[model samples]
Target chain A: MAQVRNKQVLLKNYVIGFPKESDMEIVEGSITLKVPEGSSDVVLLKNLYLSCDPYMRLLMYKDTPVSLGFHYSPGSPLTAFGVSKVVESGDPNYKKDDLVWGVTKWEEYSLVPSAQILFKIDHTDVPLSYYTGILGMPGITAYGGFFELGCPKKGEKVFVSAASGAVGQLVGQFAKLTGCYVVGSAGSQEKVDILKNKLGFDEAFNYKEESNLDAALKRYFPEGIDIYFENVGGKTLDAVLLNMRSHGRIPVCGMISQYNLSQAEGVTNMAYLIYKEIKMQGFIVSQFYPLYPKFLEFILPHIREGKIAYVEDIVEGLESGPAALVGLFSGQNFGKKVLAIAPQ
Target chain B: MAQVRNKQVLLKNYVIGFPKESDMEIVEGSITLKVPEGSSDVVLLKNLYLSCDPYMRLLMYKDTPVSLGFHYSPGSPLTAFGVSKVVESGDPNYKKDDLVWGVTKWEEYSLVPSAQILFKIDHTDVPLSYYTGILGMPGITAYGGFFELGCPKKGEKVFVSAASGAVGQLVGQFAKLTGCYVVGSAGSQEKVDILKNKLGFDEAFNYKEESNLDAALKRYFPEGIDIYFENVGGKTLDAVLLNMRSHGRIPVCGMISQYNLSQAEGVTNMAYLIYKEIKMQGFIVSQFYPLYPKFLEFILPHIREGKIAYVEDIVEGLESGPAALVGLFSGQNFGKKVLAIAPQ
Candidate 1:
């Protein structure tokens, strides 16, 4: 077997606080372009696009919780959900030339188990990059969390935090699609503009400009919020708790604001949880993967008709992966941040 | 109509921080012996037992949330769940000399709306004082919160905070009745002893003595907690979050520790909700009232068989109501705290 040059991003050390680009290094490695002989569940993949998410930060620690499933140690390639093509296969489920998206190594080529392949790419009419974002993990996260957990009713008030990010943007649109009155908050004015004008949100605000988030939320939701899609926890969650109506639901998808802190900020207004009879639950995308087919059946027509829109912040080359992933912590990415390495 | 001297506990003023006996005062007032004429929903009651609860502290605030209902303005008798005998009735549902337990004013005689009566007292085999604790609002609170919200399975590890309080004591007993491995935490060693020896808890601990609450929880629940009945919020709740198993449930019934704080203590470990895939819900007892019949059927047998036991700390006379209610904030009451104004 011959070897080819494989550029990879490797974890240099365990990250304690805010992750910087220096925490990861781009290294040139090599891989054989074929699967190991007789391996029942292995496949070789050509990495196409990689996703940058807030939860990725949790896997960088020295000791992660068992439930998080995958974590990387020092001196090894980082792993993430990526859009890839099957180059060689030993698994009956996947074959050469098949396009797929799931967990893969942050390298030019990866040999992984077939179980990690969440779903094969079946629809090709939309942007193939969509599988890396709105049609993939983030999509299912917004769909299952909002519809299944939120249980939103028509004409109800809905609020989304980090509204311009991968999951938040889609949650806002889904709320609107369900006949809800939607309001979203983002870190910057540009993202706020995109949420209100482009994504069909009823209203949007630049949270950075608001001195009091509680007052800002009151201004947006005068009667009180019915469903709070909690993407950023900490003070944002506390403010939303105060504004939530009786019997409100909070589907906690991510807590981007607290992910990097050594000591998380305390949520003080939780007493409202009892007074208002609120339900707050936290979940990850994998728990909702069973809803993929139903999600596709509901989303595909809307995508083709341009009724539901999506945004992507694409950074080119394998070397730029570190900066793109780091940008997520600072709210630097305008939308779904993806690292594009190879063409289909 | 003849009037009788009605001794009452009235709110002196709105309370801010920790409540003192001075925040309430005994006042001698008078009430007519008959219900208001032609008022179809009005009932006259001879008040007997008044219960002290953590949620009552919220009603004393100048601006209570609207969902809480029935806030007492200054110069008015404080309202609480009590056992009473109806002296006169204008509603078709009740007749003179009927026994009932529900929300009633803190006075020797109360003229209240018929809707305030939660249920008629039908069982007299148990101590009537149980109506103010186990068989009344707190009873409904414990049964509904534990079985309905906690969702305990047989042999699951269960933890309860404020284990010696009226609601916590019953929740622990209910968890054990379901065949769960139960652990409870209280502020004092005496309460801890009562939990393990009298209430049938598998293990108990004094949370105040253990400087590190997280370590204490690990010691008791070695396999991690499957259910946590949260009665006291702040540090205990934060500590409990760190020890929860994946998909654990937290039924939040009260936040006694937070009631007296001008600014509530921050709960920092909420991010565990996501990592553990936890479902945390806050609910008042009234939301589960529809399940009262089922609760009564299940618990009546246990009480008859002596499988469940309860403790009460009774303070005599309406004048002592202030001290008994204030004692709750300082963990001064050993078990369920009740005020006895008159003999049935």
Candidate 2:
């Protein structure tokens, strides 16, 4: 078989503090796109759309001491939850021309172990890039974190920080769908408008405009918040603690604000957790992978019926991967950020 | 009935930082030792053993903003969870000479609402003073925070902070009773001895002696803590977050360390909650009152079988109340500090 030129995104160094585009480099590589003879463990994939998430910054570390997910090595191609098509399959579960989504390398082609293929993309009626986000990890993350961990009740006042981002937008919409009064906080008025007008949030505010987050929360939730879907942690979490009602729930999905900082901000209002009898729980998408099928059943219909809105901030080419990934920390992207390495 | 002398403890002023003995004043007042005319909702209580709890400091504030508890006024008698004897009652639930434990004033005589009486002392086989320590509000707090919230399985690794304090002592024993491996951290070597030698904990350490709390926790909970019954929060909680296993639970019973500081220590390791899929919940004793009967059924048997041991630091006379209550913040008491106001 003739080898093909493969363009890839590689981690140039172990990141400390905020990640930069220079931290990851685009380089030329070569690969033979074929499954080895007599192999029944791995599948060869053609990477299409790659997810740019806040959690990816953790993997940029040398050892990734805190993360439960696999670490990205300095010399290797960055690994991410991606939408791919199987070019050749050595496993019974996968076949040639089958669409799938899972952990794939940031290259034109990925020869990943079949176990990393989380789900065979069974439904193709939606956009293929949706598999990288809304129908994939971020979708399951919002679903499981909001519904499973939060246990939000009808008419409950819910607050979401980073409410215009990937998981936050979906979470806000989900809360509203569950009959909750959802309020979200975003960095820009543009993002806030999308959250309130497009994503169906009952109320949305630019956190940057508000001098006091506590006062902003009090204005939205005079009776106190019953659930807070936490994405951007640190001070937002502290302020949320003060405005939480008795027996409120805080589902901590991501700490985007703290990820880039050398020393994450200290949350001072933890005493409110005791005073308000709050249950603050943390969750990841992989933990909720078992519920993906059930999630698809609930979400696919909503997406089809135009009842749920999914916004994607996508840029073309593997060369754009590093900048798109770094942009997540700086809030440069508007919605569910994705790198379009190749088109369907 | 003749008017009787009531030596009461009153808040001298609104406390801003660490409480001082001067913050409280013990003065002689008079009370008509009776339930009063046609008072069907009140009880005349002769306060016996008044508990010196850390939660009391929050009540001492002019108007407690963070506490879900009633605030104490400067000129009035300080209220606390106390073991009392009913001298006169108009409620059907209580009777004359009935021994009970509930919220009562720091006085020789307290005219409390009958509804404030939490439990009648039916299990008199044990010391009546246990009502102020092992069988009182602290007891219910330990039980609910540990068993109900922690959900410990057999052979699970458990860690309790403030191991020799009122609630922590019982939590450690309860973990042992549930067949879990328990380690405790306290401020003194004396407390460590009581935890290891007397209370049946697997291991105990003096937290004050350790320069690095994270290293100390790692040395004890090398396998990572499954359940952390959080008593003293702040730095200890931040360290515990580093040592917690996947899906670990932290039941925040109290944040005694943060209570005295005008500005509570900032907890910075909150990102660990998402990384490790941890659940850190906070609960108050009042929420668990409905399960009091079931709690007594479980606890009374353990107390009778000598499987559980409770320690109390009892001081005599009403005048000593101010100093004893103030001592809790300074780590001046070794066990559950109680003021023995009057004999049974």
Candidate 3:
């Protein structure tokens, strides 16, 4: 096996508040293009499209008190979900040249345990990058949070925060497919338009344009919201609390707004939970991994038939990985943030 | 039919902040001892023991934006749950001389709709006043929120706030009976003693005495709480959020601490719900009313065997009703606050 220069994105230091491009460094590292001999269940992968998710920011912190099992050392390559081509496999299930999507480092080529790979990308009819957005973690996240946790009913008033982003866009479309009247809040007019016009959201608003989120919710949902797919959290969650109907359900997917803050915003309207008999539940998409097969079956047809739509803010090269990941916090990316490390 | 003088506790006005004895006035009114002719579903009740409940405070507010249906007009007698004797009945379910427990007025005699009465008090071996505490609305509230919502498993760690109050005490006992390791938080040393010594809770603490509730929770629940029966919300809820285990359940029965505040304290630790994948649900006892027959069957044996215990702070006369109701907010009463308006 020949030694090759591997381009990698390494965490420069533990991120304190909001993550920045400077917090991650692009460097050259050397690795043999082969898995070690007798290394059972190991797979050699050439990383392709890497997911730039909000949860990745949590890994940038040193010894994150809140545990999701992914932590980055000061000089280690940043880890993420990506579409990869298997170069070699010690696992019997995967063969060389098989396409896969799962947990992999932000590097040109690296060896990973087979268990880290979620699934073999069998259906390659859609774009390979869709695996990082519509067919992978974010896809499962929206499916699990919206259908499993939310339990939305037809004609129900549903509100989604960060409604133009990766999981949010899918959730909005799912709600609509379920016959729910969906409303979404986004940061920009362009994102708002994508949510309403492109994603089929019944209503969409630019949260930045509204001074009072509570008033905006009331304006959109006069009868009160029956379900809220929470992504942004903080003040938006606070406002949503006030406008929730009796027996309302809040499926907290991600708190993207609070993740970067040293002190998360205080939610004051919690008493409404008691007043309205609300069910506010938080869930991680990994908990719903068992349902992924069923989810894919349900979503793949929609994607192929052009019934469901996905948007990707694709940045090319492993060098742009740091900037693309950081851009999520600032709302610089339009939809599913992805970094194209290599051509498929 | 002869008319009798009925002593009534009337709301003086819509309560703004914390309810005071002055907010309610004891007035004398007259009602005939007989049911009016051609009155369908009407029952004349000779009120016995009246329950002093936290939800009553919510009703005292004029045109409460949050609808629980019970409302108080300044000139009318305040309505509540009370053990009453059926003086006369026009409904088949309730008959003259039958004892019952349900929604009644804060007066000596009340002519009410038969539908308002919850159930006929069948078991007479126990004290009639038990219907106002251990055998009434508070009883089923503890049953539903704990067993149905909390779903505590054997050996699970359970925490109850306002542990000496009507619902909290019963919840603590039920959790213990379910083979859970239970801890309770009360307002005073007396209530704490009642929770630990009398109610068989594994541990008890006086929340008022502990300045740092989070530290106190950490001290008691080192492994973290599996279930928190939320009664007094605000700061206590904030502390509990920090000390909850992954997949913890919080059944929010009441927010007594928040009810009095013009601006309820902001719960800054709500993000814990997402981090820990917690389910925080709020519910009204009324939603679980249909399960009352099954509840009584479950609880009656425990009562007869002396396996369960309840403490009641009984105040004599309708004149003391105002003070007894106000005492709840101040944590003045030692146990379940009940006003003995008329002798059994």
Candidate 4:
């Protein structure tokens, strides 16, 4: 059979400090739609959307010393969670036209050798793009970190840094669902409003406007914070440490604020951790993959029923991908930023 | 019978910065050995050795927030862990000549109103002074922190800061017993030798002598540290963070280095915690008091068999108590500094 071809975006080199558009380039490449003769375990897909995550910044570095997720190699296409339709299949489980979501190459199409990590998108009744954002890795991250690590109790004070971001938004909502008093901090007023008015957070503040985060937290959480979902590190972490109640738990997901800095800001108030008996645990979403199905089972219903809201800033075309990904560190992108590579 | 007199050491005022010898003054006061006619739960004892710990530095500050332990009041005797013999008892559980260990006033004699947190020392075969040092709060801290928080494995590289102090010494030994390659850092050459020779550590270095702590840690832990028992925070923590192996665990017991400073030192390398997926938990020993029996069950045998050894720099007489306790911040004590107010 004549083979159909696809295009891909490849990283140019390892990035240092903040990632620039020059670090990544959309290279013209071709992939066969069908498996070669005698190959029995392969599938080809047309990717519709790709997730832009903060963790991707780590992957752009030359050597990150083996972190939670798999590292991306320089000169290879960046990998991320994406929604795709299988165009051809040699695997027994998947068939042509089956929609799936999982880690895939940053491209319009890919020929996957194995589909072990892939999950078929069964609930198309909800937004198809949800598979790349709220119903995927970010969704599972919020559930696992808040419920499993944070251990929220009703009426307890919950504080979230980067509350307007993908995982942070879900975390705030989850805290609200658990009947906890939730407060969140964002970089701008729009995000603060979304947290308080749209996401149902008890209070929200623009950390940029607040001169003193410690005093701001004291005002928002007068009694002190019981749970802190740490998304932004540096000064925010130091302030949160001081505001933590006795036996407080902090589930560290990401530190967007310090990701791009050559010398990350130092946290000075860590002594509070000992006095408060704080338990701060850093976790990767991949560690909780077994719970993904259970997480989808729990979150999809709320998303479908419109009880849970997810916001995404969609950047069109593969050429714009680099800027979209870099926007996360600068706080320029609102909500879950994603690149829509192809039209439905 | 005439009432047994209660002798007390009173704090004259709130100390500023480093405590001076004149800051704490011992005063003699008398209390009836017998409980009041209506009281049902009181005990009297003759205090032996009072534990001199770095945390006591916080107690001298007048306006510090209330914590799980008692706060020192101006013009009142300071209180800490002490090994004592019951001279009289009103509580049915305690009797004359019973050896006990608990938080007690720094004095020759104490009239304990309630024996709530006190433990009866059954293992008298070992040195009674152990109750104030290795076999007491410091021992339990090392045991719980290294075992529970660190979750060390054989062949793992363990790094301990303030390695010759009361807690750090035991942590090094405990890590060695678990078959881990342990390295430690102390302020002086004497303490470093004690760590390497007496505490069974594989390597030891004086942090004060090293020009760069990161380079020092790299020299000791070539493969990177799997566990860091953080006692001296500030620059040491920053260095350890840089050299931490992936999935490293840091059990923060105390930050002696930053305790005396007007402002805490900023830790610049905390971003490594996220990149390495490290788990840093700060714990207070009082939280694990319920595990005392289990701790004693495991540790007593080790002590009696001489499998574990302890060091104490004892200062005789109550007059030297203030200087001894204050000397800890300056690293003046050679071993687990203790004050011998009265001999058993």
DockQ of 2: 0.77
- Model 3, A171-206: lDDT tens digits are 999999999999999999999988989999999999
Residue lDDT tens for model 1, B305-341: 9988989999899988898889899999989999888
A58-142: candidate 2 lDDT, tens digit per residue: 8887767566556788879998899999999999889998999999988999998999999999898999999988999999999
TM-score values for chain B across all models: 0.98, 0.98, 0.98, 0.96
Model 4 alpha-carbon drift over 4 Å, by segment: A1-7, A37-42, A65-69, A72-74, A112-116, B1-8, B28-34
Best by DockQ: 3
The ten-residue window of minimal lDDT in model 2 chain B covers B62-71
- What lDDT tens digits, residue by residue, belong to model 4 across residues A1-344? 55544566788898888898888888877765666666568777788988889988887777764464456876788888888888877887888889888878789887776553368988888878887788888988899989988989998999999898989999999999899999999999998888888889899999999999999999998899999999989999998888899989998888888887888898998888788888888887777778988998889888878889988888887888888987888898889988898876
Error of 3 at B34 (Å): 2.2
Model 2 C-alpha lDDT per residue in residues B1-344, reported as the tens digit of each score: 88999999988898988888899898998988877799999999999999889998988766675554456988888888999999999887888999999989888999988988888898889988899888888888899889999999999999999999999999999999899999999889988998999999999999999999999999998899999999889999999998899899999988999987778888889999988889999888888988888889989989999989998999998889888888898788888999999999
Best-first order by DockQ? 3, 2, 1, 4
Query: Candidate 3: misplaced stretches above 4 Å?
Result: B63-65
DockQ of each: 0.76, 0.77, 0.77, 0.63
Model 1, A71-107: lDDT tens per residue? 8988989989999999999999899999999999889
Error at B18, model 3, angstroms: 1.2
Local error of candidate 3 at residue A234 (angstroms): 1.4
Segments of candidate 1 deviating more than 4 angstroms: none
Considering chain A alone, report the TM-score of candidate 1 relative to the true chain A: 0.99
